[model samples]
Target: MSHFPMDIIESLRSISRQTGLPIWLVGGTVRDWLLGRPAKDIDLIVPERAFEVGQHIADQLNGTYIPLFETVETARIVLRESKMIIDISNFRQKMLEADLFARDLTINAMALPLNGPFEPAQLIDPTNGHADLSRRQIRAVSKAALQADPVRILRAIRFTAMLGFHLEPQTQQWIAAEANRLIYPAMERITEEFFIILQHDKAHQYVDVMDKLGLVRVLLPECDRLRNIEQNNYHHTDVWAHTRLALAELEAILLSIDDLFPTHGEAVRHVLKQPMASTRCISDMLKFTMLLHDVGKATTQSKDADGIIHFYQHEKVGAHQSRAITKRFRLSNTETKFVQNVIRSHLRPLGLLAERDHLSRRAYHRYFRDTEKDGVVILLHALADISATRGKSNWQTRRQNLIDLIRQMLDYYYQPQPNPPLLNGTDLINAGVPPGAEIGRLLRQLAEEYAAGTITSREEALAFVKQAISPDATTTPHSDI
Candidate 1:
């Protein structure tokens, strides 16, 4: 009746009609339907004989069945058309109360009955879910309900952010009291819920709750130390706050980028905007790189004789520290490698721009060699990182310049024109060259000259190689030092 697939609803209706039992489409699907959201999943509850009803539905459609619920009889049947698992459970206990009591939040507990044709559809409101839905409040049915599944503490924040609802004062107090209970939940479960929060429109609000609940410190203890750490004149906020701002900016920019390209036109937008889900955004590489980008500041925070602060070699220090942290988190070798590359090349954006005037072929080779597949990803990360900085140092002008340089780098990166080798080992070996370490060294020297665009092809490479090996090399490669 609500624009759901007619065949599937009819399948359910037929099964209910044959069984001679009242069936109610209960829980989230009904809730989401009332909220005017898409409801792909449906749950059906019968007054009695849930297993028999489930078996009947399965037989009608030849679908898989699974038995659940310890006290009340409950089973699941996969519908043929929608392929949705219609959870079939019995309405047990004296008060028709299990439906509301079984759910975490009041708004999710409402149900819609689909019984005999003569009987009108009834809205089951055992827990005052209708009132809560109207008020836009996420309140637990009872205190015991909150205690039964502590993960609702996190879900409450997620729902609050996603639905633009507010937690009742009592429910908020309960959440504060039960925040520690989240530790008992499995990491996989926590991660699933956390990602759901991230997917929401205002996920940062959920994270803010997590921070207030002290769960962020529990989740990412490494960042806890940044809370009070001073960041010198260059930073407007403390390190932790800066990190949070960066993450917020990153999310905002990504969402803006996502909006610029509609879902249907995503393929066409690839040439203009980098795909949002590239290794740069959601990968563990991004997470670890973001975490460690400022980590070396802790170790390298130094005041010179002039009382000026410097974080020299912070990138190098952060790379090693990131590895240790990654190992502790039980990340895979590939993940660690990616994170390490991001950390190591974190400073390359600034370095690249520093020498932008005389961009050499050798510099391009070195840049490509270091970044590999993550070249573009690292550049994007750098853009986000630089944009995140709160310092007032003409960064607006500098940031735009860096963005242009990165675009040019991306152009060369995607283009297929071959980079002819300046000098090959074979060239040295064929030129009556001695079989010594000097030959390899001389080959590298010739390659450098080629990278400087001083030589273009094999003939030029041969000439350069021969000149370097000649005895009158007074005006040498590393000259005028």
Candidate 2:
């Protein structure tokens, strides 16, 4: 067996001797240790009264006790000093053999004796889990195991991607046969598993495998609808295919972001690593956005008189659709807004690039302002989207142009503001402007003009406002304007 900290070993021995209960190190912890991976969490199985044992362990180690599930006599002890979690649970059945047999996968069914010497000879493998581990394959213990809990279907995919393992043929067939059983689990559980899958570096590969097994259709019907929705010649594949490729490209960009743009690498990494909501990182959220970026194309697909396909306002429609999806998954309000805003503005970078020469300072300010702190994220998504397509002429030049645009946005974001506001709402109210919505509109206009470099001083802003409110003014003072 692999060496563990002396303190952990001694603690386990003390707990086993004090309680006089049979405790065994079980499941993923043992599996990970045998594979030479650091085990952050330890799982211990007892014949009965697992909660009492968990409480004893918590008191012994002065760790925080978390009651995970009362029904199954399961609890968790978080050892802050070691940064390790000890999960205690009762056997699923009366016997240890039955409990091990009931596990989801063979590689996770092995256990080690915790009360005695921690050695490989002490392992209790009711199934050939060690051999399966040696072969780097995920084999289901039995079909009944998965039938008991369909969430293992997703877990299988996660392990395949994370550990670089392949599913056994029987296991794959069982997954396909029982894929629909996923609906029986709580949406939160499903969402958590899906989020974990997205956290992997090569999530797209496993996601494609999930799609082939019909899991995507059962989980996200919105994305399934994009499978055959054809796009214009600008795209080499259909909507769903392009979306998948974009997701893969997103991973590639993140992996090589530092090498691709050394100047803004730190800023890019910081933005992607920030937490959004429910402990989900911004990078995982971006992967979800990329998958659903073109979902609106399915509904808004139309052919003009000359047979030219058009998805006009798809981004706007996609934003609304993405909001509904996020709500269904019970994401926090902050997360919902982040996903919706990014989807809505996914096309803005390219739109700005089309008018690169005429992109005023005010336009730059508005782009970053509307995208919020996700301006860099939106630009990366746009880059992945463009890289996935084939029909764009001067593709190399366009890619370079996008890189240049990202640098400009990053400079604007990280560096000091070029034009500070010369007037605020208070300033406007004090300048004979009424305290109402009009003040806000006029202040925003002044700020825009200031960003455009047309007005530099408070007196110039006052003069510009004066010209706008005058009867001889040709332009109207609208909120958006």
TM-score of each: 0.76, 0.92
Angstrom error of the Cα, residue 42, model 1: value is 1.9
Residue lDDT tens for model 1, 356-404: 8877566765677568777766776776677777677876777778767
lDDT of 2 by residue, 3-120 (tens): 5444785789777877677899899988887887867788999988888888889888988898899778899999868768899999988888889999999889998877788777
RMSD of each: 5.6, 2.8
**Number of backbone collisions per candidate:** 0, 0
Specify the highest-TM-score model's number: 2
Query: Candidate 2 has what TM-score?
Result: 0.92
Worst 10 residues of 2 by lDDT: 472-481
Q: In model 1, what lDDT does residue 70 have?
A: 53
- Which pairs clash in the backbone of model 1? none
Candidate 1, run of 10 with poorest lDDT = 272-281
In the predicted model 2, the residue pairs found to clash are none
